[model samples]
Target: MSARRPIPGLGAAPSTDLPVLLPFDRGKGRTPDIYLATRWLASLPPWTPLLILAVMLAWPLVAHAQGRYAYSDAFDALFRWMPFLVFEGFFFNILISFLAMAIGTVAGAALGLAQISLNPMLRRAAWFITQLFRNSPWLVLLFIVLLAFPFEIVIGGVIIPIPDWMKAVFGLSLPIMANISEVVRGAVQSVPTAQWEASESLAFTRRQTMWQIILPQCFKRMIPPWMNWYAILTMATPLCSLLGVEELITLSRQAMEGEDNHPELLVPFFGFALVIFFMYCYPIARATIWLERKYSVKL
Candidate 1:
């Protein structure tokens, strides 16, 4: 009250008052204020779809069993075959999809890095290869490989036809490689040019800077969309059935075609697909969460 506040630099931290302050910001974000109505709802996952599924399931009330198969009966049919559907149809496709995805990832990384190389001729060649594969329908690509590409491998003197399994691998890998190449190229390019310059100025070669400084950062940013694309490719693997690959959809169709099997195996088959994808993909999803947190990407 008597104008006795002349002491300086004692209230806030010293660095905040200093002109050349620490560059890092380690301060915690302010806690968000919660409103009464919305506080309890903030923690839920997106629930609209589940609510709709509940409504549909409730539509098949068994209180009015009309001596006929109700909607509940259909659900029951699905319930009976869930285990077999998961084992035969879901597991096989998931395995094949994982392998093909691994192949695509390796190919895409090489293709993308090649596209970004300083060598003009190498970039052009890589570009052409990627374009050719990307433009081709996966089914047609598989057919060409399966029907025309000589499946024979020449080892020493004897010629052995390439295993049909390898053929499917080749077919599945090509188009996925093309798509992944584009994704990788885009992700790599998305890094700011200044970052590259900063890295290079620090004495790193282009490859070293890209790998050691850039790629890890870019991929951390790219995971969500990248994972979404990978998920799509995983869904597409069943297309291998067209090429006679013994993957999930192929097995599911076979099971459905079995004697004494209800046609509704298709439903459980689809469910199995969903379950497998969700189960195995939780890691990627958690990875995505960690990436978003680590990189501070926008929600």
Candidate 2:
């Protein structure tokens, strides 16, 4: 067979064998893939909270039937201390989450940007730091932070006592920072490489391209994961109780002890903690899913 030649002033016939690209096959899709656990949480039924509440209510009755204590007594005690648990203990947990998230987000954003820096040393260092804390157990990080930090600092004839809760905040922030760094780096990289090429053609510097072009596009993509992490961080605040940070779980323990260490109080106090945490985090979970769907890249 003879080879065919191109026509003058005309391109060769367009190829008809182009590959089909399905949405799922695309690098970017309308529905981003979230963690399986997070997807499961977001898929929980609306009755979940009601069912938990019902179980909590029935717990007292079950305790009473077993002759552990009076049913009304446990309920009454839970109600009596509900304000303390919610206002003080749970609120403290929220404070820690907020502080940790703020600190982590700032540091993580910097680290994430550094991970993509042109400087090889800076990129490797950022990656090392991110992976180190990201893989470490949260409780171990908490303990390490607690032990490594001093209880107080003295400077110029002044003593500033560092509270355990502050240490907890710092501890909790380390892992969050690592995770957020990954989130940021992933979001930035997810942007089409064409953006970088386009920016380069426009005479934009790396810093200008990142700040003005890349990051703005990434902000929305980063938000859902950021909020997801915040919800996870809030739930993790209970771990601070082990460090004597006086969060919801710790105060629940104290409340039980104050109630004469009654075995029956266990169900009411701890059950309420479970319910409250669910109520708080479920909304966040739902919001995360919604935002993920909303901001997902449509390719």
lDDT winner among the candidates?
2
lDDT of 1 by residue, 1-299 (tens): 66675444674344334477455654565433212112222223444345545554554453343544444555665556556767766676667667777887799779978998899999999999999998898888878888867769788999987866567767778877887788788788988899999988889998789888888877766665456445556656777788777766666666556523544344444555555655555455455444545665443
| Positional deviation of residue 188's Cα in model 2 after best superposition, in angstroms | 1.0
Q: What would the per-residue lDDT of candidate 2 be over residues 1-299, giving only the tens digit for each residue? A: 25777654475664445585644746555455544556677799867878877887777556556565676787889999999999999999999999999999999999999999999999999999999999899999999999999999999889999999999999999999998999999999998999999999999998899999999998989999999999889989999999998999999999988889877778778888988888888889999989998887496
C-alpha lDDT (0 to 100) for residue 103 of candidate 2: 95
Q: Cα miss at 113, model 1 (Å)?
A: 1.0
TM of each candidate vs. truth: 0.64, 0.86
lDDT against the true structure, per candidate, is: 0.66, 0.89
* lDDT score for candidate 2 against the true structure: 0.89
Worst 10 residues of 1 by lDDT: 33-42
